[model samples]
Target: MSDKPLAPAIEGWHTMGDQPHLIGTRCTACGTYFFPKQSHYCKNPDCDSTDFEEVELSRTGTVWSYTNACYEPPAPFVAPQPFEPYAIAAVQLEAEQMVVLGQVVTGVDTEQLSVGMPVELVLETLHETDDDIKVTWKWKPVAA
Candidate 1:
């Protein structure tokens, strides 16, 4: 049981530690980029190319939309004890022209966010155990 943090909640999404950016796949044929990586084939409906290259997505994006989870989710979804609401946002990466959804970093709430607000990617602990801490990517509103 090494002390290092556990693997990412979803493998191959983002690297851990300083200077992290979401890992995505870019279709060399159509110039399409996909987060979570598209290893099988190009996602562009008009293209049938299977060639892709892994690339780091932009670190900054604009808040395209947001919502708050006021209620605890059903089973299989774990919520922190002493349940508290969390904010989620759809951030539009400028270079990719795609919106990625993720939880907002702690201390940021719906009140502090608005459409078109600048945001950056961050790594956060989703949960921890005696052995390791589960990490995931989160969105944080950029400072003025």
Candidate 2:
């Protein structure tokens, strides 16, 4: 029983911590960064090795694209009783060579967002319960 809050994700699994993190996969032949992870096999067509190693991703990235969720998400995702509009965006991690999509933090002014804007990842609590707390990733515009 650790003092840390129990994560909504799998328990006992080490948390990614406060820093923006990205998943990385080494080609074994030619190193390459991968997000969402290539668990099955390497995407580098030239190599057939089934071996891969996980690596932490970058914290900052540039916005590749963005959209607003005018409606509430369906199913198991719990939201506030009245519902609120949220923003989702795809951030391109140049170092990882991949695009990671996540919800924007609350109070963001959508009109101020733009493509190619610099952003950084932040860990936030989405929901909580007596035993578990749902945590997810979010992105915010970099401070000027």
Candidate 3:
């Protein structure tokens, strides 16, 4: 845990606090949801509407898939020194019915994950900067 003031690693992508949620947009016409906040235009083939509204996507979901990152990724991701492999999961949100990818919480094993396993969003320190503690959303398994 860091005493530095918390800040989002990628601003405006998700909320912060005890109950953080991924911020996304919903197509006003077809009621479709998109992460990364799709305000430009709907990707739905049948809908050419440019109208969209911001919505806080569901925090709980089932794990649609899982994998691990064995090496440091490209920029925008600040990996720690002597980087440790981390689990990644594609979770299908309970409300949106869409899969959103995220890093799994630290120390969770790949063998512990499974398709359709329930999970929830949680905030964790991704890395630290001179001025703030960079936080990001992570998927944590819901204890049965």
- Could you say which candidate leads in lDDT? 3
lDDT of 2 at 50: 75
TM-score of each: 0.92, 0.83, 0.94
Best by TM-score: 3
1-144, model 3: which lDDT tens digit per residue? Answer: 668999999999999889999999999999999999999889999999899999999999999999999989998888998999999999998779789999999999799999999999999889999999989999999999
How do the residues 11-128 of candidate 2 rate in per-residue lDDT, one tens digit apiece? Answer: 3222357664545555655676566566567777777767777777778899999998888888687787688888888999886677888888888857868999999987666766
Candidate 1: where is the Cα deviation over 4 Å?
A: 1-6
Cand. 1 Cα-lDDT: 0.88
TM-score of candidate 3 against the unseen true structure: 0.94
* Candidate 2 accuracy as lDDT: 0.74
**Runs with alpha carbons beyond 4 Å of true place in candidate 3:** none
CA displacement after TM-score superposition, residue 19 of candidate 1 (Å): 2.1
Which residue runs of candidate 2 sit more than 4 Å off their true CA positions?
1-14
